[model samples]
Target: MISRKIILTFPQALLDKPIVYKLIKDYNLIFNILQAKITPDEEGIMILEIKGASRDYNAGISYLKNLGIDIRPLDQKIIWNERKCTHCGLCVDICPTQALSFKRPQMKIEFDKRKCIACELCLRICPVKAIEIQQ
Candidate 1:
């Protein structure tokens, strides 16, 4: 598996749209939205992790750039908030490959980002929208 990570800058307007989801589906590639940061100027910085063959990686990048995401590679840490997470277990159930899980006593969910296919099911199922995919 060839893995590539990219930091993208985009207009704030795109944030309101599910462009990332669309890109993932169109390319049939795997990705994880690590972080999303909003600037004072209303621009968005997104960190994304993608995995696939080399050709697929380049193709995915080209597709994203075509859609207007400024792509580059950088090192960054992504954080997930467990407090706002409802523990409804929607994310755990949605993982097709069982990449995420909920601990019984701790009542916390764990995400194995590498195992994620970037299906966006977790993001969609979180009723509170507590999970933020940052760049």
Candidate 2:
């Protein structure tokens, strides 16, 4: 099995298509939508974590590329500024996936990028403005 987080950008012309559904039905892929902003007649952006057999996952990605969907790795979307962080633990408490947490004994905060879903919860709650979206 393979799991990866990706960002999908849908052009206006593909906004109403059932692209994600096809991934499941045709490719046997499982997807979890972490965040999305879709507006009629406008560009759509979504953060999704997809899991499936390695072959199926590769095929699904190829299908998406063939359809003109802009795909990017989710790791590039979120930025954590270590210098500005105060380690107040506010973001740790608000992160749903526990991507931000306090390290034991050291009491320093740690950010696990793989576990982050790009939900933006931490961005809103960080007192020192340490977390930001990279666009």
Candidate 3:
């Protein structure tokens, strides 16, 4: 099986299409949507975690690409500037996945990339300018 996190932007023409449904019906892929915005004929955007067989994954992505969907890998990450971090732990509190944690003894913030869903909540919650989305 293969899994990937992706951000998809649907053009105005593709906004009405059931793109995610096509992935499931045609490629047998599992697409877990983390976030979405749809504006009828204007545009559609989604953050999704897709899992399926390798061949199916490839085919599903190809289908989206053919439909003019803008797809970006969500593997891009948030960078924590330790030097600027104040160990306030605001990020830890707002992290839905608990990907950010404070170590008790040393009072240091730790980040686990695997547990993060790229929700960007921590970026908003942090008091200092410590969390930055790496482009």
Candidate 4:
């Protein structure tokens, strides 16, 4: 039972209609939404806790990546700075796994380590390059 936390980033526009239920229905994995919030620029961010066999966990990540979702290991220590972010919402919009929410008026963001599959989208999309994956 090597459980781990995964962080996922998604577009805030999706929050107008959350796809989390669909993900649960499609993936058929037991998941809990630890944190959820939207950014002022309309980005949806969330943190998830996933538990299961290592094989199953990897399989789930593969499935999500195949679907074009952004997945990343949560063990990494990441820090966000508002000054660097341009509010372009690229990270929020491209997230396929619905792990990120930036739709809040304050542009608040949350991360769910369990749900992440380690796709590494945030690492690639962040313009200011604020997100980092630790381990």
Candidate 5:
């Protein structure tokens, strides 16, 4: 199966449509939502990971673009700067994927980029602005 992380930006007019639903039903793709903020009559944005066959994945992406959904591949990275981090663990609570964890013994904050889904939670929760997403 092909898996890809994507950031989807939907216009206010498309807010009422079942876009993700169609991606599942018609395109046969599995979508996992990492973070989302969608409201009717307002622009909606979502960070999602989609898994499917190569052909289906391509088709699904095409369908979204055809509907005017702005699709951006999450190909960059999220990183933690140890120099800026205080090891306070504030970012740990907001990370749903447990990508940010407190290492035992030292109680130091450790970031596992492999486990990160780029949800951007740590970026907002870090008071010191140590967490960064390299776009």
Candidate 6:
């Protein structure tokens, strides 16, 4: 089995389509939606974690690409600037996934990339602009 985190951008024309249903029904892929902002007649963005056989996963990605959906790796979208971080622990409190946490004894902040879901909550709460979302 293979698992990947990806961001999908849907054009306005495709906003009403059941694209995610196709990923499950046609490619037999399992998807977990980490974040989504979709509206009628507007572009939509979704952050998802997909899991399936390697073959199915590839097919699903190709299917999306063929339909002109813009896809990007989740890691490329969310960036944590270590140098700009102040270790104030403000972002740690807002992280829904606990991706950002305060490390004891050292009194420092820790980031676990694997646990992050790209929800963007930390991006809003960070005082020093340590977290950012790349288009």
lDDT for 39 (candidate 3): 37
Q: Could you tell which candidate, 2 or 6, scores higher by TM-score?
A: 6
- Looking at model 5, residue 16 earns an lDDT score of 82
Per the 3 Å backbone cut-off, how many clashing residue pairs does candidate 1 have? 8
Predicted candidate 3 versus true structure: per-residue lDDT over 19-123, tens digit per residue? 789899999999888877553335666789999999999999999999888888876688888999999988887676778998889989998888987766577
TM-scores for candidates 1 onward, in order = 0.51, 0.58, 0.57, 0.47, 0.59, 0.59
- Of 2 and 4, the candidate ranking higher by TM-score: 2
Counting clashing residue pairs in each candidate, in order, gives 8, 0, 0, 38, 0, 0
User: Please, what is the whole-model Cα lDDT of each candidate in the order they appear?
Assistant: 0.69, 0.84, 0.82, 0.61, 0.85, 0.84
Worst 10 residues of 4 by lDDT: 13-22
Clashing pairs in 1: 35-133, 35-134, 35-135, 36-133, 36-134, 36-135, 46-135, 47-135
Model 4 stretches with alpha carbons more than 4 Å out: 12-19, 22-28, 78-135
Q: What is the C-alpha RMSD of each candidate to the true structure, in Å?
A: 9.4, 6.9, 6.2, 8.9, 4.8, 5.9
List model 5 lDDT by residue over 1-88, tens digit each: 9999998888888878888999999999999987786533366778889999999999999999999988888776897899999999
lDDT of 5 at 73: 82
Write model 6 residue lDDT over 30-134, tens digit each, in one string. 999987765333667788999999999999999999999988887755788989999999888667678998889998988898888776667757878989886
The worst-scoring run of ten residues by lDDT in candidate 6 lies at 35-44
Residue by residue across 58-115, what tens digits does model 4's lDDT show?
A: 7777776665556665555444455666666776665556566575787766555554
Model 6 / residue 34 / CA error / Å: 0.9
Determine the C-alpha RMSD for candidate 3 after optimal superposition of all C-alphas: 6.2
